[model samples]
Target: MQGATRTPAYAGRGGSRSIIALAGTLITVFIVNSLIGLFAIQYAGDADVRDQTTLARLSHALDTAREAQVAFKIQVQEWKNVLLRGGDAKDYDRYLASFEEQERRVRDRLEALAAAAGDLGLDAAAMQAALADHATLAARYRDGLALFDRTHPASVAVVDRAVRGIDRPMDEAIDALAEAARARAAAIRADLEAARAERYRTLRTVAIASMLVGIALVGAILVRTSVRRA
Candidate 1:
């Protein structure tokens, strides 16, 4: 009549409750969604870490296998030295001891490689077979050295001819295992990268969604305040 009609006291409380409700709902949605996004990203990060660990282990195993090959070559070289210079007892004993030591090193490395490969779910059967063949070849070398009568140095030639290329198959097997390991590492790296990218994309999407919702909520609050003032 004289001016605007008076608002009931309960009406102001009701309006306040409405603003509170609206803010609470939007805030809750924003917080809950952000928490979920963080948890999801953490899970993805854990998975990526596990994959990287696997790749590292495989790489170490491959290195162990290669080292085993190098030790085997050294063992073979010692065997050759034993043949050439072993006419003397002292030289023969030293060369034979060196040969035996290198053989032990090779075996140890291969054993480590096998264990690592098996743990990583790789097939080590071919490498194991190669190791067995190496044992046979080593035995022949031992026998050849034993037969070296202080009189017959030419018998080394007979032993050499017999075991000339016995290592070819084992060499091939090691190469195959290395190739397989490389392929697996590549696949793991690719998968890890993809997972990282996906994680980033999901996080970006959540951030964008939250920002938009916040902007809308601010706009709504400003409008409601203006309406209340009016």
Candidate 2:
């Protein structure tokens, strides 16, 4: 009679359950990692958008500040014209009108700068300081203009004195405000960079963990297959 054929033993229910558990764990880990990666990517994109918006606002604020400064200087020129050549009623009226026009432009741009700063979530301290300086300067300018309207020749010394005291200080304050805005922009850029770095770090960690999990699952599968074959 032929010898009875030998048969391999089954891995049994416990082994089957272990393999299922490992497969389930691997799938769950993969899904979780994918979701985490997607979230990180979206967060990074949002951060980039915020950074771009902030930079644009900063540019607008700086431009407004510069334009306001130019308008202020034009107002000073108009004052000089009124004090020097405004003896005639026509010349005096023309210069005064020009001064008023430039003043309005300056005030408008200053307000725009303040709005931009507020939108960017920046402290409006510098802008407020500049505005206060502008107010003080405007008061002095009006005083000089009043003196000139009544007596043009007598207005020369008064206007010159106010220009030295008020105009120069106002210009300096505007310069300071512009510098502060630039500094704030730099800080925002730095913050964005830091956030990006953190995002990358998290992604790296996730990638490493995923790789380790894959290795472990693969090793466990190989061992089980070998035992089954044996």
Candidate 3:
């Protein structure tokens, strides 16, 4: 009897190779998608960090501005008190000392706000306008103090007039800046949340796709082995 020729299992070999190729393609796609997702998450995180840093600087600036405003108000009140007391020598001297200290504090706060404005990319024109207003007010205060040092009776009246001129506008400007800073902070926080949600969605999609691919690869392996045994 002639020995039968064994046929090469070309079909089975092709099928196995095709399955392997499909699995490799799926894995490559998954890896590429994962890398892209990771890069996006990193970029979002970096943006959020930058925004948070800016917010912190703005907060500090606002605090300094508030303190300066408070100091200015106190100085004005002290001057008023001195005038009420009929400009006694001792009271006038104390008022002068307090006024000088408060003026210095306001200047320091303004400098800090300017630095923070640079960091936050704030409107330069707005900053300039505010600075000009503050400088005018400060100059008036200085002139009043100089007159008071010479025992001029009109010094108290000048200081009171200067305070009245700038107080409301200055307060409004500070409030506006503070409100803008708070709004920006809130926006950044919202952006962070959106980024986090997008990241989670990407991860979930990758997980589901990976699980499906894994199961398909396992099924193909099992089917090929069983056919061979049969």
Candidate 4:
């Protein structure tokens, strides 16, 4: 009789220990799941923030690149006007001044684009080379203008021949740079969209998983209580 009573006590102790161990396991899983959820949320937020900041930067760089192209185009037109109206001293001076001003604008924009490219991890070498080429081209324009026979008709041809096609390389370089910036922007925009979708899915999945884990934990505790009462 004594041994039988002692066996029951031992069995009760084993049952209590089993219940405690199971409860501990559930709590540990819950904590781990909660931590994982927190980590996922943090990761998503950080990625989204980085994407937004990068997109904004890319947009600015693209705008600067486009503006640089426009400025360079206007500069070229002004150069042509200088040759076309070289007979009129006033017009020549005005257009030449405008040409220089536009050149300066182009330089500023290109430099800005280069800096932005560097920040955004794009190829800035082209912008740098373009700047150097633009400087050389400006100097050539001035030198070419020295051959201008303002008193002679068809003297514009002389200036054109001197400066003709010299700008082609620089123009191509600038266009290529602009396209690069545009492509980078497009890629980032796409990544941002994908990341946003992924974040949503992650959040939804985590929420569901956490809810299920919580429900399971509660159910386990209720069953444990009933077992103890029984």
lDDT of each: 0.76, 0.76, 0.65, 0.84
Better of 2 and 4 by lDDT: 4
Q: Which 10 successive residues of model 2 have the least lDDT summed?
A: 5-14
Q: Which is the leading candidate under TM-score?
A: 1
Q: What is the TM-score of each candidate against the true structure?
A: 0.80, 0.76, 0.64, 0.78
* Clashes in predicted model 2: 0
Q: Alpha carbon lDDT of residue 66, candidate 4?
A: 93
**Highest lDDT model number:** 4
> lDDT for model 4, on a 0 to 1 scale?
0.84
| lDDT for position 63 in model 4 | 91
**Please, what are the lDDT tens digits per residue for candidate 3 over residues 69-184?**
67666756665665655367877677767766776776676666666666665555665676777677767656655544336666666656645555568657755655665665
Worst 10 residues of 4 by lDDT: 2-11
Model 1 C-alpha lDDT per residue in residues 162-193, reported as the tens digit of each score? 66777677667666766766676677678778
lDDT of 1: 0.76
TM-score of 1: 0.80
